[model samples]
Target: MTPEEKLQHLPDKPGVYLFRDTAGEIIYVGKAVSLKNRVRSYYQSGSRLSPKVRALMNRAADFEYIVTDNEVEALILESNLIKEHRPRYNIYLKDDKSYPYLRVTLGEDFPRVHVTRRVVKDGSRYFGPYTSAGAVHETLDLLRRLFPFRTCKQKLAEGVMSARHRPCLNFHIGRCLAPCSGQVGREEYRAMIREICLFLEGRQDDLVKELTRRMNEAADKLEFERAARLRDQLQAVRQVLENQKVLSTSKEDRDVVALAQNHDLSLVMIFFVRGGKLIGRDQFLVLGAENTPEEVLTAFVKQYYVRADFIPGEILLAEMDPQERPAIEEWLSGIRGARVRLVVPRRGEKKQLVDLAAKNALLALQEVEQEQKSRGQGRDACAELARELGLENIPYRIECFDISNTQGEESVASMVVFEEGRPAPGQYRRFKIRTVSGPNDFASLKEVLTRRFTRAREERELIQTGQLSTRQAKFYQLPNLVIVDGGKGQLSAVRKVMKELGFAHIPAFGLAKEEELLFAEGRSEPIRLPRDSRALHLLQHLRDEAHRFAVTYHRQLRTRRNLKSLLDEIEGIGPVRRRALLKAFPSLEEMARATVEELAAVPGMNRAAALAVYRFLRG
Candidate 1:
């Protein structure tokens, strides 16, 4: 059916609407109370709309809607779609970094405590999207000193009293419970783990009380060593509790949220209050926000809390639409398995907290703007590049590729990207030159470009066919500009690949370091730019970064190959032992520094093999 006819038939129910352009790509996703009225309003002539929405209407050709049972369901579905597709016209929570979390592998017989940046459901418990990696590291270190949980990667047999493994140095140092040795009871180790979890969850008061009781009991029983350990742990927990700021006297869990905006850039700051104590705070940058603060606040809340691990019973917002309050609260409460409230306190301590959050947000927004300015990301580098290249379209996203190898050994390629003239390290990808056999930069470049664009085509096709979400397609987001680190030869290779892949329309360039010249397709004369030009500097930075990344990967592969070869010469070392040694000590230098006893402590290593490894590395 025609788009207009389909719009006319849209049901008058709570649902999510997805608008796609001619290429069958979703450009915008939104939720509506009445699909008929909301979706139809975009088509209404002379209706006032923000420039962002107006731009959306210009490119949106067809749309599809999914009706939900209620507004709460619709709200959830809308948030999921936006996160999945990350449509061009929808506001984005520009949080690219995967915040660190403390994970406990609960499914294992003896759970281990560690820090991780990825959260997956492997029967594990995850806590804290900690603001900084260093902060999480410090917390993990403190926890290890407080509790005795094993951090080793050794696989232990469950409930086996006569296990064959020996306890490591950590066991002797009182840093681990040594579950692998089968001497530490599983329940005992798990009890300590549960205490650590309580501490991480901001239940330090309860933890202190439990530790005090245990210490008193141990002392009465004349267990001097155990009593001392418990006493030390209790004192530590009390110290931590004292250091935490108590934000409220009510002892209730809640979050105070506020936002600050500068033109299109918006920052949302949230303070996490657990047990009426200030546990943590996080800030997010909002992209493509709407004209109103209410809309931005709602979008931020939905986009954030959807992926949140913990939801407080109450959320205090600086501003929100009154009509949106009920649906948001209902959605959160459903996720939390309890009733939740969306509060807008006009007067009281909550109001003061919200104001504090707003001030923080404002400061953070200013800092971000200043950083962008200093990086020249908010300047005219893109326009300058277009003018210099005489291109028809301005490049919003630029991608550069480079090849690295030493004498045909461990050939590798790196692809680096810059969006809005800022380096996007998260999107950078590297490839081990599979097809090329020698130090052939031309062939390697051709292979890398071929793989990159071929995967892009396949991913785009999958997304269009509803087989894959946009975010799942890593290569589908085509860059507006392509760069290769070479002269005319690399540019020709990229051009041929682009033509074959049906992406000939996209602009491609090759940059050579000597004289800093740029080569484009069908141009016999290389384009020369002033050394001080912003566009040239940007391209130079990208090329250098790509080279550095590629060379780094190449060196890593070479190092591994060398290490494997060296270990293969050891008398008692096989593939398993080699891998075990490598896993234990990533560098040969570190391995060489290990004592025979230290080497024997590694999993699957016997004393004879450990002595052999120690002698071989030394020799």
Candidate 2:
């Protein structure tokens, strides 16, 4: 549908809108207080969106919306839709795990403590969407120690309704109240629940005082065991509360925000607090962002906290956003249970929190900037390389192929990937030089290039269909240029493979080691780089890395054979034990003197066998 037709159909009510691409895939999702006005704004006069937005709109096939009762409902619906579809243009919370909450399911006659990733609007009380699993585990531990909440997954799943046959380890350790076996009455369990709720709601001091009073009463009644147990729990709770005093003292809800920017990236840190206690913190680092403090500050807030698990009473920012602040505050207030405020403190304790968060973000951005700066020099040198080879563009990510072996014995092919002129070690690949019997560089080059280009062709199709094959995709993407460590014949060999793979468009060239010269496809004479040119240096670096990678693989094969030969000399060790030892450790150097206990852990090597191997190696 055209923009005008869609705008006319939109309702002036709060809702979520979807932008579909030419292939009918949802490319973007957004929430608006008034669907008609917001959707139409894209086509209104004098209103220009970003270049990215314009590109998205140009490809947009149609739009769709779901009207809601209120802005709050729209906000909630938008979050759900974004999660379900994972629209490309949406600022996504990428983790597959749901935002967690501490759930106290009291609907049952017997209450249970559980950690849940989702927050449902059920009658049960929920505490948090804690960002860290470690924090959640620690909180559960504290609760179990204080209130005798069940910690066993099996017991909880089984719903210990009647009681357990025997009090488990938790009861003996005083971590559980042991009501599951009917040791504690319902009235007593209810009282413990009240105290737990109080403690969770930031009334720890009062709860402690009341518990101490109850303990004294129990002692007066000559209930020594009950009083003793209460005493232990009270001390534990006090210690936990004391340890949490370092971060804050107010016990009020607030979020600390900070921003950092580099030449092409930015980072934001958001610290969430509830009841004046630190709950969790999230850090967001954005790529391809420019170095403007105000723009970075604005983008960080809008992009990072749009789907915040918990909205605070106040948002504390390191820098102010004058224009976007009003819109953000309005949007946030609708989602939060109560009024939400946005502040940029000039000088105070709150400001200090923002400052610390900002400093951390700045350090992170500085590290990224340094890395990018280092890569910039490499990329510039590669640009010179493209010019030297008379190619279309800079070889930012170049792939080089080489063959290795001793006269075709254990022959292998190696492909090394370089990104922005630096070796991407993880992307280095090895092939067994299939379809070639003898030590023919020509045949080896054709086989390796065909395999590489064929996979590249298939993956490009997959990417277009929004189904990337794997982490290996970047290596398979047609490089800006290709390099081989040989003369004109090797270059032609790769060119023929590219033709067979239907990818003749990819430029293939070779750098012969003897003359230190480059030869491209269809060229008889070689092209050489200027002795002092940075481009020449970059090309040489790539050639050297590819050569090193190929030679290293050959050396490793030789080393493994040597190690196997040594193992064969030892009578007790066979192929099974040899494989086990090698698999268990990184290298022979580390496994050279492994202890009996360590050696026994390797499969097929028991204590006797392990000792025998150890003694043999030691001797």
Candidate 3:
């Protein structure tokens, strides 16, 4: 199908769309309130699609879409589809591992309380998609201490089969009601669950009252041990809540998000207030954003909140996007099941929250600016190196390649991009080093960069032909510079390949590992930049980010390799068995720490296998 024909065929209805190459691989995915209108905008003048997309259009042989019942549904479906397909053009959240959430299964007879990541309409109540997994687990731990609701998934699976077996270690540790053992009666467990629900709902006074009543009842009944336990649980919950500061008490749950930008990067800070308590704060660095702070924040709010299941009762912003406010508010109100307000607070507590969020935004931006200042020095050094090597431009967009491996296992090449003066994560690329057999950094880097630039050349042609679409490369076009994270040897290797491929215009450089020196053609001695130079710092940031990205992949590979080796000694262990064990236990160190009984409890590991593991660890 022709690209223009595919664009014409897009439905006018609200939904999500996918763009596919001739080989039927999805290159990009996007959603729209009006699919046809939005899709057509790409061909319009002044669209933000990068030059690379403009070239890739010729290869986009077909298009596909799924029409949703509504825009919100479309938004959710788009997020799921993107996660599943990992389309190359989408702005990924980067961290996709499911984080824990507090789940209270109100419909169950025993009402199990546990940590889960997936939230579905299963007659259970869920509290958060908390940014911090540690914080979520801590809160859940405190809840279990305050009220010993059932933690046994087996009990829920068996439809509340309350066998009076011995209590698990959690019961001994004072974190469970031991409902499985019938130590806590049904009525008592129900009452405890109620108190926990109240506390989670921000009715601390009611929770404390119920706890007091239960403690007194136990004392009067001469159950002094039970009374003392309740007293300790109550104290723990109170202490935790007291430590949480109140951001506002206007009986509203809200979030204030503000963004700030300087030169090439952006900073976004989110202030989370739940039931008037300032739960915590988070900030993110957005690289390669060509939009203003307000513009970025507006898109962020729309994209982020529309995909989230939980909606705040209100959202106070430092900057306003009037065109977007109504749609956002209307969308949020539906999710909240109430009238949700989006306001730009100018005074009082609401305004204070905005100010707080904005302050955080400023601080985050300052950090990025400081980072850019350091990187600018590196960029200048790289530009000087390029000049010494007889290159064209200042090489503002630098791409660094690094290969990581452990003695030939899990060889991978990472490409980290620095645009203007910062590490652009959105443009960072990873290659599994397909051609090289074992631990050949030069070969791996050559193969990765060659493939990258080859595809880039093809994309540039498609774009120039007016065939490619913007969705393919919104912020990722092409790098003006390439820096291999190695010395003159690596630089010589890259130059050889570039000349062979007949691509000569783009400049390239290399940084030596020893003495932290820079290298270029015709420069007999290595060069250095001032510590505070922004351009040089930018190059260093890119190089470090490449190292970091490569090291991270290397570590994951190493961990998986170690996990497999550990499992190999077990009698029944195979690929699936080893994977399950690693997924459940994570590390050899963690597996070593687990008791034989704990190891046996993991799904595939039986008594014999667990014993085998235990003996191996001991040996």
Candidate 4:
């Protein structure tokens, strides 16, 4: 049906509406109290729609609607649809990747704690969408040091524990109670797990009280060793608690969200407070923010908390639209299985926290703006380059491929990425030469290009099928333009691979070192830009960086090959043991400096083999 017909037929009940372009792609998604009124409002004369909305209508050709029971359900569905499609016209949460969470396997007989990137419904308790992997590891390390929890995957049933002769070395090191040893009772192990849960949930005061009670009970029973361990754990917990800033005296869990915007950039800072103590803070950067502060905050809160595993009962925000507050809060409260409040603190300690978060967001925005200025907004440069190349689309994300090898020994390739004319080093990837041999640039280029695009397709499929997430897929984001570090032959090879991989629409160019000219597909003449052109310089920077990265990776591979050969000369060292040793000590020099004990600590190695390795390197 035509968009006019769809809008006329839209139901009066609360629901979600989707506007699609000629290609049938959803360009925008929204929910409203009345679908007919909200969807039709866009087309009303003199509506004074924003430029973004006007642009959306310019491309939009059709519309669809889903009737819901109530406004809250419509709001929930709108958030889900926006996250799923990521419509161009909608405000969205940036870096919408799966953050690491601390998972406790409550389903298991003896629960164990570990960090996971995925949240599944397996009766496990999850806490966190930690912003940093390093912070997650630090927390896990502290937990291990303070609590003797098992790390291994040992099944400890009534008969299984009795069958095992001894527990792993963790028991000896006091890092685990080793329930499989048939010594520690299930109740005792479970009690420790409970304490861990409380500690992770940021209920430090309650945890301290529980630990004190347990310590006193152990002392009353004359269990001095257990009492001493409890005493040490208590001291550590107290120290951590003391360091945490007490943000409130209410002991209620809530998230403080505040936003700051400058021009097209927006930053949202959120502070997580539990049991009245400030635990952690995470900030998000939102670009192209064209809405009001209240609208942006509403959009952010909806997008963020939709994927959040745990929703606090109370959410403190600087401002929210009064009309939308009830529906949003109702939706959140449903997710949390409790009544949730959306508070706009006028004056109080909570208001102070909101102000502080806003201050942080402002500071973060300034630093980001400064960094962007230093990098130089390459939008104009990209546009100029696209125009010069006679391309239809601007290359917002450009990926260049380069191969490096020495006589085909230790062959490797590097994929360097630049987004909006700035280097995105985190997206850069290196591939080992696996298929072809010798210093054949064309064949190697074909191989790496083939692998690059092929992996992109695979990761895309994995993400679509719910088997993999966008963040975990290294090759998921395909480039707008491709650059080869060679002339016609290399470009031809890359073009062949791209066609085979069904990505022929993506333009490929080859840069010749001698003339500094670009060779384009289907064009007999090479494109030449002036020496002082910024576009030419940008490509040159990419080519040079790719070469440097690929060469560095090749050298590291060659060093590892030499080290492996040297280790193979030892009588007892086989390929497996050699790889292990090389992996443990990256270089022969480092291995030579390691003592026998250090070498023995490596997996699949004993004191005898460790001594052999030590003597062989020393001799």
Model 4 worst lDDT run, 10 consecutive residues: 163-172
Question: Which of candidates 1 and 3 reaches a greater TM-score?
Answer: 1
| lDDT, candidates in the order shown | 0.86, 0.73, 0.72, 0.87
The alpha-carbon deviation from the true structure for residue 388 of candidate 3, after best TM-score superposition, in angstroms, is 26
Error of 4 at 307 (Å): 6.4
Better of 1 and 4 by lDDT: 4
Q: How accurate is candidate 2 locally (lDDT)?
A: 0.73
**Candidate 1 residue-wise lDDT at 229:** 80
TM for candidate 2 is 0.57
Runs off by more than 4 Å, candidate 1: 95-97, 161-166, 289-291, 377-619
lDDT of 4 by residue, 203-283 (tens): 777899999999999999999999998998899888888888988888899999999998766888999899888987888
Clashing pairs in 1: none
- Per-residue lDDT, model 3, residue 372, is 63
Q: How badly does each model clash, as a count of residue pairs?
A: 0, 4, 25, 0
Q: Which stretches of candidate 2 lie over 4 Å from their true place?
A: 1-71, 77-255, 261-266, 271-315, 319-345, 366-384, 392-397, 404-411, 419-422, 433-447, 450-476, 496-505
Evaluated at residue 296, the lDDT of candidate 2 is 56
lDDT of 1 at 393: 83
- Residue-level lDDT of model 2, residues 142-218, one tens digit each, is 78767886555444322454663555545655567667677777666767777877776556667888889978988
